[model samples]
Target: MTFYFHFLSRMTLALISVGLLEACNPKSDTPQQPSGKEKTTKTEMLESGAAILQSDSPLQPMNIYLDGFHAAKDNPAHQMEAHHFCRQVNEDFAQCVLFDGNTRQANLIGIEYIISETLFETLPEEEKQYWHPHNYEILSGQLIAPGIPGIAEKELMKDKMNSYGKTWHVWNSAPFGKTGDKIPLGEAVLEWSFNQDGEALPGLVEKRDQRLGVSTNEKRNDRAELKDLAKPQSGVDALKGKFSMPAHPLPGVVDKKAAGPK
Candidate 1:
């Protein structure tokens, strides 16, 4: 009987110790979902890069959205917003981390690497399939930095106009209507750009403008003179443009005015 009582007391002591541990650590019992006000683990991981960024850091992170359809034939246009922290990895090459749209708590969704046209032209035809021109993105105002002045934006685009971008999106959030994504789940997709009006959703751009407090239409109008700028490799297909892309689900494609990718 005495031994039984001792075992019961030890079990009670163990339970009490666990309770004390719980008391010491409020989050020990429950997992934490990142709140809007807090920087998520993913955001921290991505932003931690800023610490290592060169003091001259060619480009600070700029928030922008790209409107396009997924690689699937039936997929409709979705506005893909990303915060690009562009840093020069070398003299003529730069790399960027594409984080989710959330300014406060973003997750790393993809990556973009930019190279000068001089360097791009050196790439063999087959090798070019992985890259896309930035002119279409720049002139159309689809690639925008919100709240910046007109001249500042123009200069920014001008610098990027001839560069080439290679992007791969790992987080597929279009099914959620571009709302939210917690984890980087599912297959990685080769992302494309909306080269023109017919290919993009009208409302998505407006929603992005309102949410971001910038005007895509105004930016588009300001860039009218830039429309004639020659983007030679802005081809109809990713291969023609020399954009390297994955085989499955087609490639990061541009649509011809004819039937639309359906």
Candidate 2:
């Protein structure tokens, strides 16, 4: 009888302990489904072990995160959101790996290398065609650093003014009106910035804003004081007259050469 009572008490204690543990560490109501393939128990074990054992020194410095939109240079309407995991190489240079989304399941779609105007000027005139200016992206507030304070974001934008980015999209991972390919396909294409209003597909920015809980127009207004820091940038007119709708001018974003002698 005493043995039975002890067993029952132990079982009750175990059940209560499990209930307390579950309450402390609740599972997500909507668990994340990363990638199409489900992770098997073996794969999950291997991944967890590798994470504990592996050294990720190279990836450690990719701390800066920025989200922006991109359009194909050859086809302006082929636009998509780019999440940048960047490493600042120096005062005048930075490099980024572009992803389709901010989540871990996001597809690695492209790369972009940014340089200061001084570095950009040193490039051969022909080489300049591949790079797109950033002033419009900054001033229009389409580019943002999620989770950062507004003041810090604005300061980051100020530093990026007059810079230029050379980008290439290697994967058509997330195309509009179609399911994204499971693997990368097609030739890699040059991507450019939205230099003018109405260039991005309708609802592209809106959908992104809704998902991220941000307002592009609000950021644009907040950065109005930083307008004075913007200098005319190269490639601002690269997509001139490309969109179906008329271009609406954004103040403080200008093409360097266009702003110069006629």
Candidate 3:
């Protein structure tokens, strides 16, 4: 998800595509014999074939599950749900691979890399433009790690409130297959967020809050003080705005494009 990852070789790209295809299709210990046929687990598939390719890559054994939205780069108004599988490679950084919501045969959608605020500060100004703050993602409850306890999630969010993320969405698969293809297709887009009250996705957040049994509005009250800790990059405000930010003042531009056009 780095801004400069466009330099990857065709060979490396081929390996990533194949390795991810093999690894992302997770399997269960429960028998998969509806018709008495045996289906291999994602782990097994990787070991048998993708292991070599996966070995060449940094991410291994993706362990965490998170759900968040990706704002279409050309149109920040279009927020798309991204199912994530994350691997924290080191103490300072974690990279997440995003998939379609369909856990069954979920397609590779995109990726995001998160880094601590300290690390973000060390980056040069040009590089900083690629990162966005986690303050709203946390306080607004837009970022969630599913299948975990609420208390644990709160603690986790506390730790990540000041982190910065660099994201790129490569696949444009529609939630309802409304775009017509099941294949991963399209150019990569830089994502944005609904950091303000009126900018939120109505049905999207409503259903997510219902499923998680939590209120995003209430999280705002809970993390009222956390607002003082974040420092979003300059370009982040260009898409999400910077009205009540803790970060230094920066340029701002609201994305005018929409998913289905305004």
Candidate 4:
């Protein structure tokens, strides 16, 4: 009977030991499954990527170009003019225009130059481009609205190959291999002639002339008249012209007069 009791005691001890081992290594402890909360957080991040791309951060590669004329691009005004020309094409076609120039947004006037791939690569890895790689560099500056200030202004339109929400007015043919080996002088003139026909050339010249306060056409007489009326003169005349006048003068005219006399 004592031997039977001893055997039963040993069996009971063995059973307890097995139960302790099982408790230490729980059956449900197969590597923990991801929590529902964690999965939801990841999903939210994916959905927000698009909005992040369009944000004002310089890193985002929106089509907006700033005035780079203050930087390293050899000629500033000519560069701006080229951008302006493309703007005309973009506007006339009601299509996106690819262009490049002195973009004010960059903060560095003459030192910074923006390129297509450079801008696109600036975007974080998640967002997709509106154009193919080849299509992006070559036709990117093809204006959606002629001379629309890309980064300078915000508006929605199909630009070049991309139906983008906003873009800057500037372009580059060299980086895309459109300009060939020759960094052509007076390329702006050639480009103007190459792309524009009929009255387009005259219109561009007229626009430039107006920008400089030099008239290229007699039709500018109307603009000239408007310019004369917008000037602020002594006391009462200055107040009436500046504040109460119905028709605002063309932009540069007021400044031009202000420089000359009282």
- Give the per-residue lDDT digits (tens) of candidate 3, residues 98-208: 776625456677788989877987999788767766666776667876654455556666777667788887766643213424454567878765455545445767765
What is the lDDT ranking, best to worst?
2, 3, 1, 4
Give the residue spans of candidate 3 off by over 4 A: 1-60, 175-180, 211-214, 231-233, 240-262
Per-candidate TM-scores read 0.60, 0.83, 0.64, 0.19
Which portions of model 4 miss their true places by more than 4 Å?
1-77, 80-168, 174-215, 229-262
Scored by lDDT, model 3 comes in at 0.58
Sequence-dependent TM-score of model 3: 0.64
lDDT of 4 at 245: 19
Which tens-of-lDDT digit does each residue in 19-78 have in candidate 4? 752332112111112223444877778758956765764332222321111101221122
Which candidate's lDDT is highest? 2
Comparing 3 with 4 on lDDT, the higher-scoring candidate is 3
Locate the minimum summed-lDDT window of 10 residues in model 2: 24-33
Please tell me which model should have the higher TM-score, number 1 or number 2: 2
Expressed as tens digits, the lDDT of each residue in 20-131 for candidate 2 is: 5233221211112234667799999998898888866676556566889888999987877888878777778888998877655666788999999999999999999999
Q: Residue by residue across 170-217, what tens digits does model 1's lDDT show?
A: 775433244545456677666655444445444655655665566676
- Model 1 bad stretches (over 4 Å): 1-79, 174-181, 237-262
Candidate with the larger lDDT of 2 and 4: 2
Clashes of 3: 0
What would you estimate as the lDDT of candidate 1? 0.52
